[model samples]
Target chain A: MSPFLLLLRLRLMEVFRVRFTGFFFLGLPLLFFALVGVIFSSGHPFAHRRVVMVATAADENRSSEMLVAMARFTEIRVERAATHEAAMGKLRAQIVNAVVEPLSDGSGYRLIVGGFDELFGRGLVTALPGHVELAVAPLERWGFVHYAFAGMLVFCVAISGLFGMGYNMVRYRQNLFLRKLSTTRLSKSTFVAAQIAGRGIWSLVQVLLLLALAHLLFSLPLSLVAALWTLGLTVLGLCAFLGIGFLLACFIRTEGLIYDAISSIAWPIVLLSEFFFPADELPSPLRFAAAALPSTQLVRLLRAVLLYGETDVASLLPGIAIILVWIVMTFTMGRFFFRWND
Target chain B: MGFGDQDALLLKVVIAAARLTKRFGSVVALENVSFQIEGPQLICILGPNGAGKTTLLDLLEGLSQPDAGEIRLFGTPLSARRYPRERVGVVLQKEFILDGITVGEYAELFATIQGVKGAQQILSQARLQDRAKTPLSKISNGESQRLFIAAAAVHHPELLFLDEPTAHLDPGAKLEVGRLLTEMSSEHTVVMTTHDLREADTLSDHVLFLVDGKLKAEGAPATLIDSIPPAARGHGTLEEAFFHFCAARLTARGDIEPVRP
Candidate 1:
């Protein structure tokens, strides 16, 4: 057998030797995709709003009609009150989005919105007559499944890449397995290539499990070309991240330092990568930082292929370029910094 | 296929170091060190902790590169580009954790790396045949060390470098390992490093004493021991002679700075 294949087999065997790691590699992504499919297939769960209608004595008829119209556009349950005081009490209890008060002149109506009901108030005002007034509570948008999937994917990649490469390389070094290999006639390039190939193969298994789960439970559509691209990109991304992890192992002496640095690098990458939201939606500097991250490129690429069925290499060229640059840079850095006999 | 006698010698000089020097950020680990050995010679490099013994072995084994020197094996320069991996075997100090892999699996993997046949024969030779199916984690420390030796030698390397191979072993295991090394020297050039003077005296056909990053003395163990000053010789032990040599060097150096006093 080729030296590369021999080393690759050893690495794969090592990865599977860790019991929970095997479960994590197979189980976690499946659970994530299943949860995403379930949640998104339904709607956003934490975004409910209530709209309230209040009628003044003079314009009671007009206010009632406006309330009914607003009800058609939302899940609003109307509560009628004889006085404005009673309407205010309902608003305070957080049971309403807006209280509509009819105008004394009988020409228009006024809608008083609760402090916590912005979406419903906005919907009511925008969907109602020109003379209608609205007081809207501030809106807090809850993330949906698309957002959740993006976040989970970033997390999965970071956890898998960091611990997988860091712990494995350190173990190899501490055990002198790498030192023994260094004594061989095998080139450093071949050794590194075997490592990347090993990680790529393992990540492919993970992606397959994730995709299978996505298909069965989430009804995730699979375009042949898109699926292939997603798989390729995932492998590429794994190589890049694993390269960084190898570099971390090379530079850091202690396992504790390695764990700390890995987590420190990983958490920030997750928070600032814009995996769960558009970069434009984040703070300005954070958005700029996110745009430059490899994770961002990977997430964008995966989402495009998996969610939108865009498999054109031309469309994915930028993301692919970013990930490719990361891979080359990290691999080169690792090779440069690695000490064979420390 | 048949080979001439000259062709046989050509295969015997498994390792050849020419002016090997290594530096770690201004501290010289090895300096102008040159050595050559042929198969059937069990050579021991004797040095204290910082005497550049491990450095020399590492350079010979291709684990590290020299700052200014060359290493040649079988008349070809030793390098990742020139040498095939199966040609050299190395046993390190620390034992590797093969995780869930059984001792047999580890042996087989090493055999595969060595590109060899008869892995079972090698396991038996290493005296690990009975425990072949046992997990590596369950193996005794001495057995682990033997397993490493077996794995390294499975390919029947042209040259072998063992760095303190018996450091963690019991007395019985050490003797067993020493015997194995003696047998291996018949087919492979063996270069082993150790601080254990007894091990050096017992196993080495040629002793290389390194002091302060340079080769201080070299000869057969008896010859080197006999060369020591008469007053320092006691029980004619090689260990006594070694300490005598090292102590005399330090005392002579110490006297140079105290001339006025």
Candidate 2:
């Protein structure tokens, strides 16, 4: 066999034999995708419907008219509570979006809202009738998990390259396989190419597994072009992430240390990349920072393909350019810092 | 089966070093070290801990560079930038092969990397034929070392560098590997590092004793052993000779403490 084939075979064998790697790198991501899909796939049940508390005392006629109007609002669902205390308790529990009651001062009815800034609460107050003073609480963004499927796919690709290749490279270094190889006729370029090739092969397998699960579990939309673009983006994303992993491995000394390093790097990228929820609500500067991350661009690319069935390569030019730049920069940095011997 | 017409004298100098010096930060790892290995022989580098023994092997293997001086392999100057690494093999002190692969697979990988043949013969010579199917992680440490030797020898390198090859082996396994290495010496030059005086005395055709980053002595083990004073050679063993030599050097350098009582 050629050295490249031998190296790739050894890597695949190691990936399967090491129980932690096999399960965590390949199996866990599919499990996460399924679990998220099942939890959120039926669409947000209450995202469009607002739970409201109606508390009226001694003004039966006025309260009845107001309740009728509130019920007529398509986004509002009115729940009547017998006492003001009960209504406020439900508001504290977040069971109701806003609480409404007659004004104790008799000038007007005051709305007691929970969980939102007073500025936004004032808007709801003005939007209601003159006799109604409105308070409002924040609502979670609806239909987020629908897009979450796309986000998780990107997350899986990024972390599979980071954690998987990071550990492998660290093991090769700390265990002295790298040093031993250095003494052979094997060139450094061959060794590095072998590592990337091994990772590339495993990453393809992972993508296929995740896609299959997504189809079976969530009925994810998978048109032919969408699938092809997803595959292409996934490969590019893996290349960028593999380069990042290599750079991290060069800086770290031991396999054990890579866990902490990967977590610290992955969590921020995952959270900021809008993997689970949109980072749209974040401040513009912060969102801009998130946009600069490779994961963010990758998530955007995957979401376009899987959610919207976007398949045009020209529309994705900017994303592709960013990912390519990341690959080149990180790979160059990794080669600069790489050391074959300790 | 061998090409015998080539002049033996032309290939006599397998490795040469002159005034080699290496430093790490403020610590001098190797200082003004010079040595040579001629033809196929077992050369032992003996030293106490942190005495630059492994450093020397690393330098000669082209894994590291010296702050000063030069090294030549096969009569040509060796530098990491353009060293001809194909003619050499290395077995580290630790078990460094991939643990997930079978012994046979590991040997095959090394063979493939070196672009050589006969992994089966190398495994058999290392006495690992029966364990060919075993995972490296499942084997005992001694067995792992032997398997590493098999992998290192897969290329039939003209020069083999082993860093403390028998450091962790049991006595029986040590002797067995020693015998194997001695047998291999007739075909290729073997250079190894060890702290075991007995093993060094038993297996070495020539010994290089490094102390505190300096070459304290060099010669056949018997020559160094015979030079010890009769009173100092209480056991008539190399260990006693090594003790006397270190003590004598320390006394001359004013670092040895005077005996009391």
Candidate 3:
């Protein structure tokens, strides 16, 4: 077998022997999601939740007035769909809670099957003279639990990248474990690859499980497309985060230093993220700055696919591009400066 | 074992380090340290503490780049791209094993890195088969040391570099490690550094004495012993030999006060 396989196997055995490592990754994020989900699901829900819906009509002018009248609620957000078929596609994809189209007689609107509160949709139904049709029942008792879950999922991945792979490297180097591997036939690339692959496997498994748990707990909806997109985005995000961790590990020696140093980078990304507040509510001065953080990008992109059913390639490119830059920058710097021993 | 593009005829030339110099900022660790090994010889780098023994070994093992020198293994220059890694085993003085794994897992990891099998056989040779499943942290220091030796020697590399294998061991453990090194010398060329004079005297077929980053003397133990004058050879052990070399290097460098008449 290749040394990479051996290293990965041994690492997995070593890490698995300590169950706490796996649990720490799984438990903390699940708890965070549960706490938030429970608070929102029990009674109080988020106020004026922004809902994206696609409106289509034969005449653009008529739909414009309907959009104007609907904008009065401030809770409902709207998007224009080019056709009834387009609106139906978004509604089916959960991109929109419901489609507001002209009635058959073109006199009123009809509420379609959706995953939003009936009462919230009622304001539109009463003004538009439409009846409610339930296709997907409410997944969340209050505000959408999926958005909060996305942030918590990002938290899990960020911690895993920053601490799991990076901290372990520093510890191994300090304890002379890496120096031992260095003398063997183990090449630098193989060693690093093993770390990345192994940690990625562990992180992906936990994240998927957390995804499933979110579905079961709050009745959150899941689809193959959303799960697959989360996987792709997560893998990209992981590479960037792991690269950052690796570069940091190349310099820092102590475990305490690894914790403090990485957390200093990750916590800002998390704290300034929607993790602490709804994305729209981040303090105004820091809103743009927070949106630019890798964690924010990850959370936003993850939220798009998971909750908004946004798998649009063009819309995701900017965030993906920024993450691509991180992946390139961190791994390049890390590979350049990494030493087998401190 | 893999010796990519290495000449088969020159395989016996295990190592040839010429004018090897290494520096740490301003402090010189090893200076102009030249040496050669042409057979499966048990070589000892005998030195006093801080005599650059480990530094020389690091240079030979390709762990650190020498500031000014070249090292050739099997007639191939030691570059990261071309070093005969498959034919070498190394156990650093400050090396450590991941403690969270079983001893078997640790040995298996080494075997896998070298692309060989028989971790069980290695553990058996180390008398650690019974403790294969035991976590590395739970093993005694002696067992840990034996495992280190066994794991490195598992692939039977042409050469093995050990740095102070018996430094912190108790007498029995040291003796056991000494026996292990002796057995290994028969099958593979072993280069080890130590400040323990008796251990060097008892274990090495050839000895290299280093003092203050310089090769003071080297040859068969008998040749070194014979070179010392009978009167100055008090008990005539490697201890006396190393002290003799240390004194000579100091005198040659004018690093010591002139001896009073």
* lDDT of every predicted structure (CA atoms): 0.70, 0.75, 0.75
Docking class of 1: acceptable
Cα lDDT tens digits for candidate 2, A46-154: 4443434445457676667667766767655566765665555445434445777777676666777765536535655776666767655453332244367667888
**lDDT of residue A206 for candidate 1:** 77
> How does candidate 2 score on lDDT?
0.75
CAPRI band for model 3: medium
Stretches of candidate 1 above 4 Å error? A1-143, A211-229, B1-34, B67-72, B75-86, B225-237, B240-261
Better-scoring candidate (TM-score), 1 or 3: 3
Clashes in predicted model 2: 0
User: Which 10-residue window of candidate 1 chain A scores lowest in summed lDDT?
Assistant: A138-147
Candidate 2, which CAPRI tier? Answer: medium
Number of colliding residue pairs in model 3: 1
List, residue by residue over B159-237, the lDDT tens digit for candidate 3: 9999998888999999999999898999899999987778899999999988778887788888888788888888877
**Residue pairs that clash (backbone atoms under 3 angstroms), model 2:** none
lDDT (0-100) at residue A62 of candidate 2?
63
Chain B TM-score list for all models: 0.85, 0.87, 0.89
Model 2, B109-194: lDDT tens digits are: 88888898867876787778898888878887777787788778877788888999998789988988898889889988999998
Candidate 2 error regions (>4 Å): A1-146, B1-12, B97-99, B225-241, B248-261
